[model samples]
Target: MPSNTDISKLKELYESLDRLKESGEDVVAEIRKEINNIELQYLKENLFPEMMKTLSRKISWLRCSVDMNLQFNGEKQLDYSFCKSGSTVFIRDKYECNCPNEDILEESEMDSNNLEIITSTSNQTDAHDTPKRSKTYTLRVEFPNGKVFQGNVVSDTYVAVIKEINPEKVDSVGLSHAGVAVVSQTLDSKYAKYQKPIGGGWYVMTNSSTKAKGFDLKTISDELELELKISLVPLNNSEEAIPIMGISESERHRIRVTFLDGRTICPMKVLEALVEVVKYAGVDRVRELGINCCADNLILKNPAPRYKKLCKPVGNGWLCNTCSDTITKFNQITEISQKLNLGIKVELV
Candidate 1:
């Protein structure tokens, strides 16, 4: 999950470090430190969360199923099963009294057979029930250049809306949620909540009803023609903003920034535009402007210790606080452009 680029960079670093070690260079320590950083980033970004999700799903399946015969440690054929006590699950012998046992088995104690049973059972259940849960919804895809495609899409419990839009292009594009580009492989139900059975099937994709911001299609593949702003309207009627297509006016309007070099970035949110501006006019230059970068609970640069949790790197060793309202983000961009003397025009289209 560390991406091909990360893997290539790590391989190069390791080879360089080995050569440096043979040459008796002190730079070996720096390369080793960088390798450690990449490993830590992989664990943080991919490994840990994936492990947790897998564990959680297994536990949930076990809790829902009745009388699971799982062997512990591969030595004892214990007729153990899980029982729910409020929110916590406790293990108990299948033949024993209905009381929950105090002792709980760790994941390490469960043998490969036990894990296999759980995984297979979960998959079987999903495969069996998916067809019954399938429903049709209105799919309206609007591109950055103002091209729109309106159609109907049938979705199962597992299939995402992006996949339903264009199965071949799903890998090339992703949907945006909370200003973050959510992978196309993620379950649609995870982001868009099913409101009712209106207009074939209605689902809302906005901050109020859902975490979905809009379609964040990327031109990562040659098959994808357009790269800029794309919006997927989930409703049959665009004017009525309830039950389906519940995006606010701000979420609907795309922010466009024109730089001095005749390069322009349009159909992005305020925060995204601000991040691009910072990337264009380096972090050091923005700080030198002596303008207050902090807005709402966000500290754009030079964040205090308390705000560190809310900050993410925005190039050049600078952190941008992500905790801010939409309106505050717009104001901050305006202030940043005015103070930097960049004469960059920020417009909402």
Candidate 2:
């Protein structure tokens, strides 16, 4: 790797660990947690589907939408609940945001108490000047533990409270004003540019006094249960998505995508290249990890027998479960092969 050493959430993460260590929490526990997070058998290292499953609390990451209430100043903003769905979602700041409302006029505890609707009117001579946006974003984050907290994210430039998180335990994930952007996949390096998703998601709240009030998620109200669901993509982040079309597969010939690291990646995994603005190296072109520098480079195997156990034999290579969709053709080998081919290849290590 041009850059890669150890996994550390950030300087703040280490500081949190120090705090936890002072409290008698084993630091080794934190290290092991990171390893497990990175080593999880993802859909070809595709963090989106699994993330969707974890956030949505569903078996399959295929559903279209979830039940969520988007209230503005106290009234529902959208005509219907969030009906749009995607592979991933983002809760970040964007300059050209057509996303409903960028600024928050006012925010109160999720209640029907006294509320007001405020709009801006420009009565100045210079019409080129944009109107003043809201100053504060009252952020009320509810948890599965029947507990809710109130806070705010600055309108234009702001950071709530950033803290470290265990990637393995996303169910207990919550939102706070703290500025930590996302839950990283590693605790080895502090640089977030190389974070698992390449970009962060969780806003790590680090105020020592800001204790979580309610108990951990236990019995969630049926009405609030849907609020926990997360779609495959956030409506805002979908704009940059690359379309994966005309996917073809077969037993005699196949296609799939793979990273330069030789790790298998699902279809959407290709879109991840957008994070670094790099051209995706299809599976067929990428050699296994350590091909040029390792002594095992020349070695080859007859995986015809061993590989079948892991994936269905297709075209010239075995298909990964993530890339192979046997949705309709269970018995047809060619159909299965064609369906499984992701226009990628894998050189076994």
Please identify model 2 stretches exceeding 4 Å from their true place: 1-130, 134-136, 153-167, 171-181, 185-349
lDDT of candidate 2 vs native? 0.27
- Candidate 2 lDDT over residue span 1-349, tens digit each: 0001112232234456556765554654774465455334222233345346696666355644332322122233322122123422212222332444212111111111221222122244365877664332232333345444333321111121112113324312322112221232322223333223322543222221211211111111121232321111123343332221111221111223354456653332221221111123222322232222112221123322212222222223423221111211111221222344433332111
The alpha-carbon deviation from the true structure for residue 151 of candidate 1, after best TM-score superposition, in angstroms, is 28
**Candidate 1 — which pairs collide?**
none
lDDT per residue (tens digit) for residues 1-349 in model 1: 4555665577688789867887655758789888999867766865577667996777775533222223233233434443322322334453433333222112222322265676687666554465454222343344555655444442221134344344334322323334322332222544445321212232322332221223232222112544333333344443432222233343344457898888998743355676787777777776666544333223354654333434567786776664454344445566678877788877644
lDDT of 1: 0.47
- Residue-level error in angstroms, candidate 1, position 241: 14
